[model samples]
Target: MKRGWWLALVTTLSSLVVSNGAAADQSITALAPFEVFADGFRDLRGIAIDASGNVFVADREAGTVTRIAPNRTRAVVASGLQHPVGLAFDFAGRLLIAEEKANRVVRVEANGGRTPIILNVTRPRWHAVHENGTVFVSTQRLTRDTDRDGDDDRDSDDESDGAEIILALTPSGQLRLFADGFKGLQGLALNHTGRCDLQDPDSERRERRHARCGRTDEPVQEARGARTRQAGGSLPHG
Candidate 1:
């Protein structure tokens, strides 16, 4: 099963129209693409590296979280999830997951069990790391029917409540939306001073266009106009 999935993913990614600038810098100098890691993941969306260098992957299609050890041994850390994507670790060593289908973020305890950390999170895809034991999540806003089948025209505000919100979840379990109004924002990260930054393929293009006019520092806020067209989604938190 895993072999088949890996093959499919490799074929799909090879055909994807990725950003040239970002892909150019992501290559590993010492390791070839095939040798960088094992070819066993199927629809792997997000990945997180622990302080000890262990790799945690969110397998969306498999609905599981697989941990890759330094020795390259793979094991399922958590399973039975509903399309888990973004995986992050809190300050106290809790495994946090953003389950897209469930529209919530759950935490795996030290005992290897799961608990709901935050729910109804508007299709969260990426998470941002913040100081003082805070984690920020990026959620997608409900919008017009992408399928154009005239199915989602019932509630104009249904997606508004779930609209792109950057949530700051405290270690003590408190949650708050720090920012909002992004379309399909994912891949969140924070700069040294705690500002949230994300990579949106559409927004990046807009930034490049503005760079022609010498606006190098694209606005450091939510990407209210951009959306993601990628298959797998995950938040990489350091």
Candidate 2:
């Protein structure tokens, strides 16, 4: 159970993605990628660093969560999770994982114990933990089949809440749809001023098309179009 992983984007605090010598600035020195711990990772997905400088890796295929210590030693903190992807340390240093196949997010303990934080999530992939303990989760596809006719032909799901949705989960366990109508939402990041942005792959030519949301009950559009106004930037406070 080796725990090494690619450590480019998760070096210290921020990650910079450069292309074709785009970052030729003298102040920016390109660093070589290094493995932190032992090798042999079956499927490494999301990576996170804790407050204590400990590195955690999520193996979606192996169904395990591994922690690489500051001294380079590795240990399995949690296991048996289903397709754990995005990982974030909460305010208290607890590891929260977005379990995609499980359709929920779970808090992993030091002794391999797990506490289900949210449920009924559809393909929850990446997530962000707000300073106030509010979790913002991005889902690929949600199935809200009202008619139960074996097909999710709901007008609401097809219109606004279609194949993608951003969900907000409160510390008190309340869940709400933050925003919707996205195609390639992958991860999430929040700036110091408390604005939400998505890590999308489909925004290549549309680079500036980041879905930024406010902390209020109103939704913020990614400047998408008319449907964006209806898909306000905030969720109703629980």
Strongest candidate by TM-score: 2
Candidate 1 clashes between residue pairs 3 or more apart in a chain or in different chains: 141-163, 142-159
In candidate 2, what are the lDDT values of residues 1-238, reduced to their tens digit? 1112212336332333222233343344548653224345666677788767787888777878788887878888777777778888777878888877766677765544566676656656777777687778777444444112212323222323345667776555456667665666656665454556665555442211222332434453231110111112321111
Off by over 4 Å in 2: 1-38, 144-162, 205-214, 217-238
Whole-model lDDT for model 2 versus the true structure? 0.58
TM-score, each model? 0.62, 0.66
lDDT of 1 by residue, 1-238 (tens): 2323433443343334233444466753433243345445667677776766676778777788888788988888888776787877776777888877666677776667676766655566777445566677766643442212212334322332443656566555555446554554546665444445655554452111111111113343333332221112333321
Q: Cα deviation in Å at residue 38, candidate 1?
A: 1.9
Q: Provide the lowest-lDDT 10-residue window in model 2.
A: 223-232
- Which model scores highest in lDDT? 2
